[model samples]
Target: MITLDARKEKVGDLLRVSFQTQIKFFLSNTKTKAAKSVIYNYIDIFTKDVEIINLMKEYEAQTNKKLAITLPSEEVPSRDAWVNSSIIFDSRT
Candidate 1:
């Protein structure tokens, strides 16, 4: 029998993005059926740099564990900072 144990490494702060999305769908039958329309809006995301960094710092201090940050790989081209940071991708990739 063999037992293996590996320690995790520390990571850096994550880069959060702020975005907005709006969607609308409609369906209608002009001859006999009624019409229906669905609208989904007011979807947005925002994160403050200072606040996020502060939170990350606090978490690291309390947990004493490495923080693994995540970022979108494609967005790297748009965000220069991601160029030097790890892409922290998931299985979806």
Candidate 2:
């Protein structure tokens, strides 16, 4: 049987790989400079979220126990960020 920790680790790895692939695809295929800029900013924000990183580490440390993750109450990238991203995405299609 696969252990819970192993399963979690695999899922995390899969998500990271998936995001990386998507980012690469967008960067390569996105024609406009503005769209690429938005994607780059999103990547920067994601990588700099220390709270999320800490939460992940905590969860990894307590894999065997049932732990409730209380995400940071404050939104990371605010609604404005999504609006910009959405506009960029929409422009591509």
Deviation (Å) of 1 in candidate 1: 71
Top of the candidates by lDDT: 2
* Candidate 1, residue 54: lDDT: 51
TM-score of 2: 0.33
lDDT of prediction 1 = 0.28
Stretches of candidate 2 exceeding 4 Å from the true structure: 1-3, 31-93
Tally clashing residue pairs in candidate 2. 0
lDDT per prediction? 0.28, 0.43
Candidate 1: regions farther than 4 A off:
1-44, 73-93
Error of 1 at 12 (Å): 25
